[model samples]
Target: MVKYGAFVLFYLSIVWIVSSCSSSTVEPDAARLGYTYFPLEEKSFAIYEVEETIYSLTSTPVTRNYQIKEVIAEQFRDLSNEEAFKVMRYSRQNTTADWELDSVWVAKRTANRAIRTENNRSFVKLIFPVEESQKWNGNVLNELGADEYEFSQVAKPFTIANQPYTSTATVMQVNDSSACNMKRVYEVYAQDIGLIYKEKILVDYRQTNNICEGLGDIQAGVQLYQKLLNYGKE
Candidate 1:
């Protein structure tokens, strides 16, 4: 009777352990959480103000500013057989001018990632569970030859164009090479609001083979940035 009781007790302990392990392994819904950072619902839209600057050794620096509006127009199946939202983008030289259709972009969200395609190049912009210091190749499938991007900030507060965001994520990409010069791009996103800010800068330097012998090397650079101004929902 004593041996039988001991065996029964061991069997009960094994069942308890298995049950606990199974419960612990269960994960929350990744798709639901990922969509909060990159919403792709039809008729959702955002507007931004863009600033561009160009620096060259041959002439003075040039600066231009504009505004862009992005709206989710429809849905379609992407090449990967996934449902993607088609976004229509419009731009204007200023707020006073009328918006002109600029381009169409595609965005899709999966259980683990959020992707956006522009100009025929697809990019993985966000990862699930939104953690800081998480790194992935934003241009992995695009063949853009860019470096791995990093989530430098998560759930941080940021403001753009006088509008404040309580929680935001910042993804940073820095690519420095002798052949292609140095470039850095920053993309900031707010929960349920999509991208709020974007900045890109590229710098290249080389010796000038001109008649001016004392001019030495020439430095040329370009910077482009966008800030969120307003948004609307359907």
Candidate 2:
């Protein structure tokens, strides 16, 4: 009877160990929890309407409207020995025009942060378990100037192109640096999707004091923006 009891206890111990191991192996649902705002999966794609405005101190502002289609083409390893996805961007003059390949970028996500490379410059795009008011030096690893990046809002409701997102975050450039030349960028991301909107503005105040007189104090600059129109994921 003693030996039988000991065997029963041993079997129960094995079962408990297995149960614990299985539970530990389960992965956390970052998407469902709204922890990861940018989901970078292959074949995932988004379409946006792009507008670029150039303001000149001596002349009138010029605005150009276009369409952009961004897609995750494939996966590859970046120079840092980290896994990354290749993103392709196609642009056209309008919705009725044909798209032309514009540029290619790379994006990588780790446990703590998301990194993206564009125009030969790499920067941290997002931080995991996103929290509002979180600040970081986005250009720290890039050896660029101390450009501050901040999460202005987290898990907020946002709407674009008639599509509403329950969980959205806005990341903004908050540093005042001469290197920026009064340039600023803002990016918005939606849960389970990727970038929903982006805006870049450059203000050149040295051109003329009366520049942009009706608009603001700036002399000359450019404003580039993109808004998500649709998205699909495989």
Work out candidate 1's RMSD over C-alphas. 8.0
RMSD of 2: 4.3
Residue-wise C-alpha lDDT for candidate 1, range 43-150, written one tens digit per residue: 988989889988897898799999999999889888889999998999999878998999998889887888888988899998786788988988887988866888
TM-scores of the candidates in the order shown? 0.77, 0.81
lDDT of each residue in 1-234, candidate 2, tens digit only: 999999999999999999998887686668644446878889989999989988886788889999999899889887778889998989999878998999998888887888888867889888776888888888976878987889977889998777788889999975343532576788999888879999898776553443333335555788898999989975
For each of the candidates, give the backbone clash count.
0, 0
Best by TM-score: 2
Please give the CA lDDT of all the candidate structures. 0.82, 0.82
Stretch of 10 with least lDDT, candidate 2: 206-215
Instruction: Count backbone overlaps in model 1.
Output: 0
- Candidate 1's C-alpha runs over 4 A off are 1-32, 175-182, 205-218
